[model samples]
Target: MKKWLYVLGISGSLILTGCNGNAEDTNAETENQAEEKTEEVNEQQVKKEILKAQMELTNTFKPYQQKITAYQAAVSAEEPDSETIQSTGKEAKTAASEAASKVEDFTIEADLPEDVNTAFNDSLPSLQAYYEHVESALNENLEEADFTSAEEKFTEFNNQFNEIIEKAGFPAAPDLMEEMS
Candidate 1:
């Protein structure tokens, strides 16, 4: 009876230890899962920020595009109304200037990779330069305009924007140079 009791006691202790080991493993697994979930949530947040920044950048530039469209339509009119052309031209110039100013303020506050953030932040200046060029070219009370350099500047910005967004796991932005012409 004494030997039996000792054997039973040892067996019970072994069983209890085995159960405790399993509990520890379960706790570790749960921690790993929680960490993974948090990482996924953070990644999603970064993506959202990148997308929002892209939209803002696009929106900021849109007014200038609309004004350009109005100017183009006026210029292409059969009679080529000088009054309409001048008004639209001035509007476009103002829009470009406004866009340029806004671009400087349009920053991606996303917590992204350093390269991605730098690329995004750096690209905006090119867009600003594009608008500045357009503004300067249209500064004089304009009858006609040439936007070759401005388009080039825009292309530079667009390409950089596309690269950075793609790096951040998004598709390229729209090609706007043709529309500009």
Candidate 2:
């Protein structure tokens, strides 16, 4: 009877030890899963921040583009001299450049996705190129040069600017029509 009792005690001890080991393993796995989930959430937050910054930068560019368009139209109507047109063009370029610099200064608190970052970095150079082209076109006398040609160049630049906005996945500016209604 004593022998049987001793055997039962040892068997029970072994079972309890096995159960404890299993429990510890389960807990460790749960902790690892929780840590991975937290990392995923952090990555998502960073992507959101990057998207927001891109949108703001695109929005700033729109107003500058609009101003350039208006200036171009004014120059077309009056056939301004080279110096006068160039001066106005320089002012517009300066404004655009300043806005671009501000966009560059925008800081993100989180890591940007590689693809999005590459796209954004590419946009800056294209924008700079468009600005240079516009400046060159504007420096010419409207009467001495082809007004249509200048308009075409402006249109091209505007299209490129809009393309950057599109690639950044930015939504169109909110329509005020609904609010007014």
Each prediction's TM-score against the native?
0.70, 0.52
Question: Could you give candidate 1's per-residue lDDT for residues 153-175 as a string of tens digits?
Answer: 98898898778666656555556
- Go through the candidates in order and give each one's C-alpha lDDT: 0.79, 0.56
Q: Which pairs clash in model 2?
A: none
Candidate 1: the clashing residue pairs are: none
Off by over 4 Å in 1: 1-3, 73-83, 105-118, 139-144, 171-181
Cα misplacement distance, residue 102 of candidate 2 (Å): 5.0
Score candidate 1 by TM-score against the native.
Answer: 0.70
lDDT per residue for candidate 2 within 1-181, as digits (tens), equals 9999999999999999999999999999999999999987866665476656545555656666665655565567656566655665666666556644654554433356676565555545545545555555445533233345434543554455445445545565322112111
Once superposed on the true structure, which residue ranges of model 2 sit more than 4 Å away at CA? 69-123, 140-181
Candidate 1's error at 47, in angstroms?
2.5
lDDT for position 60 in model 1: 55
